[model samples]
Target: MLSSALKAYVNAIDDPYTIYMDTEQNSGFQEELKGSSDFEGIGAVISKKDYYIQIDEIIKGSPAFAAGLMMLDRVVMIGSGLTKGLDVNQAVSQIRGPK
Candidate 1:
C-alpha cells in the first residue's frame, strides 16, 4: 500500500525514467548500464515499470536524441498507437531496431 501510493505520487510527477528500485535491482541495474550491448532502439535506454515504459537515457548522438527526446519521458503512444497496450517486451520489440 505504501509503495503503491508513493509510486502513484512519483508517477504523477511526469518523470518517467525515475522508478523506485530496491537495493538488489538498483545494484544490478548499475552494473548493467555501465556496459555496452549491441541492442538498438531510438538511441534511448528504457525500462518497463509497473504500467509504463520509462526512458532512462538518450544517447547523445543517436536519432532519438536528435529528435529531442529527453530523459524521463514516459512513452505514451508509439507509431500512432500501433504499439499501444503492448507489454514491455512487445513495446521494446516494436520500438527497437537495427541501426
Candidate 2:
C-alpha cells in the first residue's frame, strides 16, 4: 500500500498510473504470472530533438525525485556520463546500479 504522502505525490503527477502497479492475484503459486516481465525495464520516456532516454523511476522521497526527476523527465545524462549511445536496457542497468 502507498502512504498518504506518496499517494498525494503520485496524484500530483500528470500520469499517476505510471507509478502504480497492479497487485491483484489471479491465483496462488500454482498459477504462472503474466505481465511480470513488463516491469523489468520500465522508465519515463523523454524526447528531445531526436534523442530519448529512459529514466528509472525512483521512490517518492528519493534523492533522484527531490533533484527534479519526474515520471518522464528527459534523462540526458546519468551522473557525468551522457546517455547518447546507451540502449534502454543499458541505461536501466546503469541507473539500477551494479547487478
| Top lDDT prediction, candidate number | 1
Off by over 4 Å in 2: 1-50, 55-58
Task: Please provide, for model 2 over 1-99, each residue's C-alpha lDDT reduced to its tens digit, 9 standing for 90 to 100.
Answer: 465465456557857344432232112111222334333322232222235674424444545556677755667787689988776556656665653
Q: How big is the positional error of residue 2 in model 2, measured in Å on the Cα after superposition? A: 31
Q: What is the TM-score of each candidate against the true structure?
A: 0.53, 0.41
lDDT of 1 by residue, 1-99 (tens): 876686578768876556665454354445445544654456666666557776776767777889989887778877767444567667766775435
How many residue pairs of model 1 clash at the backbone? 0
> Looking at model 1, which ten-residue stretch has the lowest summed lDDT?
22-31
lDDT of each: 0.64, 0.47
